[model samples]
Target: MAAQQSQGIQTLLEAEKEAAKIVQQARQYRVQKLKDARSEASKEIEEYKKAKEQEFKAFEASHAGTTSTTQAALDKETDAKLKEIEALFQSKKKDVVNTLLQRATQVQPELNRNLKKLQA
Candidate 1:
């Protein structure tokens, strides 16, 4: 009976050691799996970020082209309007100067005649 008890104790110790070894192996596997998952997620995030950056850059480039074309058209219209105004000013300037000169010459002769009569 004593020998039987000693054999039972040895069997129980072996079983406990095997259970501890299995638990340790499971913990190591879980840690390695978590590390792998984190690595995959980080890679995917970086790829998504790069794709978004490229998309935004393309959008900005298109917007800039549209803006430049619109600005050029607006500038052309402004230049045409300025030219028309300049032409109108040039065309009217000669007539205005000639009329003023004629009026001044006619009025001066009458004023001198009146002054001579008053002196006499």
Candidate 2:
């Protein structure tokens, strides 16, 4: 009977060891699955970023010609305005100079009131 009891105890210990090994394997599998999920998520985010960049580049390329043409039109308008102003200045310049010259050459002379008191 004592020998049979010793064998039963040994079997229980072996079963406990097997359970421990299975638990360890389960934990390792869970850790490996978590790592794989993170790697997949990173790959998805990188792909999304690249796709957005390409979309932005396409939009910029589509608008590039319009931007340059609009800039050229604005430059032409500005140049026309400058030419009109220069022509107006040239047409008025001689008249303005002649008026200034006439005002400078025409002078009125007045006698000092103190001269009478000095004579007295």
- The candidate that achieves the highest lDDT relative to the unseen native structure: 2
Candidate 1 local lDDT, 14-113, one digit each (tens): 9999999999999999999999999999999999999999999999998998999999999999999999999999999999999999998777434577
Give the per-residue Cα lDDT of candidate 2 at 36.
Answer: 100
TM-score of 2: 0.64
What's every prediction's RMSD, in angstroms?
A: 10.8, 5.9
Among residues 3 or more apart in sequence or in different chains, the pairs in candidate 2 whose N, CA or C atoms overlap within 3 Å are none
Q: What local lDDT score does residue 26 receive in model 2, on the 0 to 100 scale?
A: 100
Q: Give the TM-score of candidate 1.
A: 0.58
User: What TM-score against the true fold does each predicted structure earn?
Assistant: 0.58, 0.64
Lowest-scoring 10 consecutive residues by lDDT in candidate 1?
105-114
List runs of model 2 lying over 4 Å from the truth: 1-12, 94-120
Total backbone clashes of candidate 2, pairs 3 or more residues apart or in separate chains: 0
